[model samples]
Each structure stands twice: as C-alpha cells, then as structure tokens.
Target: MLIKGYDDGPLVAGESLLPRPGFWSNYLMAICGNEPGASYVPEWFGDDGADADDLSEVLFDPERWPVFRAPAQGGPGVVVIYRNLLGDYGIDYLLTHPGRSHAQHVASWEGDLSGTGLSWDELIRIADTPATGEGVKDSAARLLLVLPLLTDPDLPDTAPARLTAALSEAGAPQDTASTTAEHLLAQLTRRSQHDPTWESPLSGA
Candidate 1:
C-alpha cells in the first residue's frame, strides 16, 4: 500500500502485520495500563493448544494487557501476536530463542516508523555520529509506542493534547507533559519536512 500520507515517499515492499487500527491501539492501551477493549478478548486461540478458556491465562487474566510482554536480548522470550486466519489472531511465545529483529539484548531497535520519513537505521546513525540526538532512541521509541493512538482520527481530542494527557497519566508533571507532548509533535513535524509522515517511541518511555 502507499501507506496514506507516504504517497510521495518510497514505495516499500512489505505488508503490514498486526491488525491495523487495533494493533497499535492495543499496544498503547497495554502500555497505558488499561484494558485493550474486548476486541483483544480472544474468540479462540491456537497458542500452545490453548482453548478459549486457557486464553485467559495466555493473556494474563488478572494482570490483563498490563502484563503484555516482550523479550530482551538473551533473556526469556515473550508472546508476539500473529495472524491465525484472515480475521483471527494468535500469539507466539518464543521460549527458546531471544528476539532479534529489534535486538532483544541491546538498545538497538529497528522497525518501520510507518508514515514517518526517518529510517530506524538513519536514526541510529545520527545517534551514533553525535552532535545531534543523533536523537534519543528511547524518546523515538516512546513516540512509536503511542503514535497510533495519538494520531488516531477517531480520538475525541487532538493528537498533541491526547499525548499530553497520556504523558501526565504516566507520571510526567503537567508542565512537563505539555512540553514533552509538544516536543514529540514538533519532532514529527520537523522530521517530515517534505510532505508528511512520522514516531517510533517505545513502550513506557
């Protein structure tokens, strides 16, 4: 797909994984310590021969999405969502291998920033070369973690305002929250000088 706003950008060759609109929203909800809507409530499951009942355990019933996990380098693995069928989803807990696509152990993370023009490799290069943030990797990751929700058109509030509330909820002082939210939005604005696109923030940053 042209990926909407990226119409003037590169024509990438990968298809989007994770149920869009729902995926990142789910991730954002999880990070915000909220329930990820009944949508994530499994209608059925396929992981580890799990039945619908067992899915409660798979998703961490009591803790809920708050416990949604990801692995670190050389550490224990975590469950990742995947397509079970056209409209179905399942999770795979890689118990044996440490995650590597985004580098489980190191601070290194690589993934498409969707509408954003910046390549993760480019971000790393800038960071490593210095003089700039090369921008903070974790800062970028924080944006990515919530960009979908922040940018969501269906949201009742504007992106910047929504992010500010989110930051405040996460413990940033109101002033800090407002400034950081504006900074994040500014980062996206400055990043796409040509046409438009954007964040790669990590969870709970």
Candidate 2:
C-alpha cells in the first residue's frame, strides 16, 4: 500500500525539491506495503524522470493502492502517516500539492476498521467526553494501536473475545485502551472532518 508519508515540517528555504526523505530508498520504504513490491514511480514525482501519470489517477489505481502513488514529484505536499492493518508495515508519503511547500493539513488515515460504518466526524459528534482535545486525540491514537489485534487475520477461533483482550495484547490496560478507542471512534460517527488537535509529544500521554 502506498501510504502518504510526506512531512509538512519546515524545510530550510530552498532546500531540495524532492519527496519526503529527499532520497529514493526512504521514499520506497514509505510507500511499500507489508512486503516491498516492484514498482516504478512516475517521473512527475522527480525520481527517475520516468513516464508520469496524473497523481489523482495514480493514487486511485487499485493495483498499488490500499497503499503506494509513489515516486511523486516533490515540492510541498501533505504527508500522511499510515500503517498496515497488521501494524507491521507503515509508511509516510508526501502527496504532491502544487504551489504549497507545506501541507495545509495533516492527519492519520485509520482505514476505517471500526466497522460501525460511521465517519470520523459522526463519531465525534455522538461523543460526549471530558477528555481534552489532545486527550481525545490520544484516545484516538490508542484505539488505532489495538485495532490490528482486533482484526488480526490469523486469530483462529476469534481475533479477540473482547476489546480488552486486544488492548492487553498491545500492552495497554483495559481502561486506558477503552478510553482511547472511544475517542478515536467518536468522530467516525459523523462525516470525516479536518479538525485536528496537535500537541507537543513532550507533554506526555
């Protein structure tokens, strides 16, 4: 899966007009899925200068998708961090956004494993919580951490008897896991929205 991995971090003016890591290897690492597959990035992305395709189409291409439009022409674009459903594989992709050296927006794509058929905003709308904005985001983050276990393919009888089981597998307590999962799912009830809550990691979880 070619997950968006571009970082919108401040780049020294006039650094390089390249993709996320400014290197091919790093870009490959970011876009490849559970296992690396042979792929050629379009030239417009500034990699090999190979034939290019409209980014939107490439992004929607079912072949490499579920994750990978790689080899994007670089400048400024949105970088979305994504991990595979199994959580073993992850990528940060820089999506090309013309004329914007920095991503106007950034967020995680959880791949809708919640199965409630609710959008992120809908989930948030239905939620009533004392959790702070950052706290909610943290809750959201923890839910994502346990989703893979809940949906694990190899789980024979049942992936997990309950959410707590999955949380325990993730080395998180039941209460903490439940809280975070609630926050993450809160917004999914409503339409997905761009509202983001960001904080310094130093603030501690």
Candidate 3:
C-alpha cells in the first residue's frame, strides 16, 4: 500500500500520522523559504524604500508579524526598543503568540530618556545577564542597548516622527502590547538597513 504526505516524505508500511504545520511554520516557510537565503527578509523588517505608512502596515498587521516566544529552556521573551525623533525611547516586554488574536504588552519604560534613568554601563550589565536568569530585567536591558541604534542619522528628520505618529494612530498603545511591539519593531527594522548589529534581536540572538 502507498501513503501520501503533504510534502512527500518516506513511505512506511504501518499507518503514519502527519501533523499539520502550525501557523508560523507555513508563514515562515513562505517568507524565509525552506532553506535560508539572502532573499529572506522577515515581515518585521519593512521593505527597502518603504515609508512610514508601509511600516505601519508591516508592524500592526498581526497576521503578518505574529508574537514570538522564548525557548522551552526558559529564557527572556522578545524585547524591542524604539526611539523617536525627539530622542524619546520605548522598551517593551512582549508576550504574544501566533495563535492569539492580540498581543500582550508590558511597558518597562516609555517616553523620554530620563524616564528609564539607566546609564550605559547599567544597561549593558542588564543585557549581559543570561536571558534564562533574569527574564524581565534581561529583556529591558537588551532593549536599552538596542534603542540608540534604532535611529538612523542619515534618514530624514521626519521619518522617525512620522513613523511614531503613524504607529500611535494604529492602536499601538491602546490595542495590545503586541501592536506596540510592532511599532518599535518597525523602527528596529529600519535601523537594520544601515546597521547590521540591529538584526541580532530578530534572529533570537
């Protein structure tokens, strides 16, 4: 007897069950491809020449950019850092899932530099801590380190401002933490264009 599978794997005599792929499995495969390549750019990272409106669509669309989870070993959740034209920063601890309709947001710090009151050394210290050790503190610290890099000096002064405003209007703060994360993620994605260092967080590094 012959058995058929979705992607065509080895055939076995006994009954074999093939579990359906999860939402992320298919989504990631389509965007990133079955094998890694230079062409793969995550949905979180807006396309080249994309404007604030384009970024807003990339960030706020849950179907496109779902919430990420930590490893089963227990580590820090995903952290996103964003900076506006006024030099304000936002740090968030994201608890979101692809299965959920909304994301949960826990703001560690939002608005203004003084709000966080963290020095560079302090911030680094926090980031250096293992994610599995100090979950919240580690995420916050990583965001702090990433915040400054999010701003691209060469970009127009209005870019960050426009993106921030657009994100706010897209129900970022009022909607869910996941939505707010998308806003910050948009900025990080933009920064990655100029600086490769900004790509680390997205890769779960």
lDDT of each: 0.31, 0.27, 0.30
* Candidate 2 to truth, TM: 0.21
Give the per-residue lDDT digits (tens) of candidate 1, residues 107-188. 1112212322223332322223322111112332333432422222122345567567655544445645675555555544
Model 2 lowest lDDT segment of ten: 9-18
Model 3 Cα displacement at 55 (Å)? Answer: 4.2
Where model 2 places Cα greater than 4 Å from the true spot, the runs are 1-161, 192-205
Q: Write the per-residue lDDT of candidate 3 for residues 1-205, one digit (tens) a residue.
A: 1111111222121101011112111222122232223333323222222343344443334232222222112322333322121342233333323344443343333321111122223223334443343123333323322343232223444444433443333222333334334344443344335543322222332
Off by over 4 Å in 3: 1-47, 51-55, 62-114, 133-205
Best by lDDT: 1
Clashes of 1: 19
Output the worst ten-in-a-row residue range by lDDT, candidate 1: 103-112
Candidate 3, run of 10 with poorest lDDT = 12-21
Stretches > 4 Å off in candidate 1:
1-144, 148-157, 195-205
Per-candidate clashes, comma-separated: 19, 28, 1
Candidate 2 or 1, higher TM-score: 1
